[model samples]
Target: FDQNPLAQMVVVGIKAGIGERNSNLSGNPQDVLKSISDRHKLEPTGEPSLQNSIKMVRDSME
Candidate 1:
């Protein structure tokens, strides 16, 4: 489904969770990156690209 509303909701929820967690942190760049990586278990150049996309969104929010 190209326009799945559920998928959008899930993304928003994820971003909100990330933002909330980030707000409580020290805001150190490396720490934030590591936190995201650890929480999501992200690996480089994966098929889904969700990790990079989430990271980019998180970076923009900062």
Candidate 2:
């Protein structure tokens, strides 16, 4: 972000043991930070699935 004017970010949260897209691709630092904050508040459950999470992120990006 702030350091990279050309950079954009997307925030994804692991939910139900899988990656869930929480925010759209954005260049705004505030939007990215808020997405992180909101996702962090959730109580985590289930065993994390890295493969599934990666797949979700990849699918969303595509």
Candidate 3:
């Protein structure tokens, strides 16, 4: 996992979701998603908006 960027990203996304769930912060979901994306060095590539990507990530956690 340490050697693979993709794996690292998956872990980061999961952490982001868990962090958000446990925190008292409140704002648009997209803002949280953007923060996670920035942390993981992800950028929207036109296929899926950041919001959709966020939804997908959270859904996969379920």
Candidate 4:
């Protein structure tokens, strides 16, 4: 995404604590990087719910 100016990206952080949040769709590489860096502050908990995460992603895309 950083290499492609036309590409847009969204980031989702799923924690084992069953928490979820996402960076809204963004085309800026810097914004995407910042979103990831900011989300890294949260320590992961138990196992991530792939099902929940996928649902969240699908909802966000809509």
Top-lDDT structure, candidate number: 2
Clashing pairs in 2: none
Candidate 3, residues 29-56, lDDT tens digits: the string is: 5454566556666432334244545676
TM-score of each: 0.28, 0.81, 0.28, 0.75
Distance from true position, residue 22, model 1, in Å?
6.9
TM-score of decoy 3: 0.28
Cα lDDT for residue 51, candidate 2:
83
Judged by whole-model lDDT over C-alpha atoms, candidate 1 comes out at: 0.42
lDDT of the candidates, in the order given: 0.42, 0.82, 0.44, 0.78
Flag regions of model 1 displaced more than 4 Å. 1-24, 42-62
Kindly indicate the candidate among 1 and 4 with the higher TM-score: 4
> lDDT by residue for model 1 over 17-51, one digit each (tens)?
23223223333455545655565763333244446
In model 2, the runs with Cα more than 4 Å from the true position are none
Model 3, stretches more than 4 Å misplaced? 1-48
Best TM-score among the predictions, by candidate number: 2
What ranking of all candidate models by lDDT puts the best one first? 2, 4, 3, 1
lDDT of 4 at 53: 83
Which lDDT value does model 4 have at 15? 82
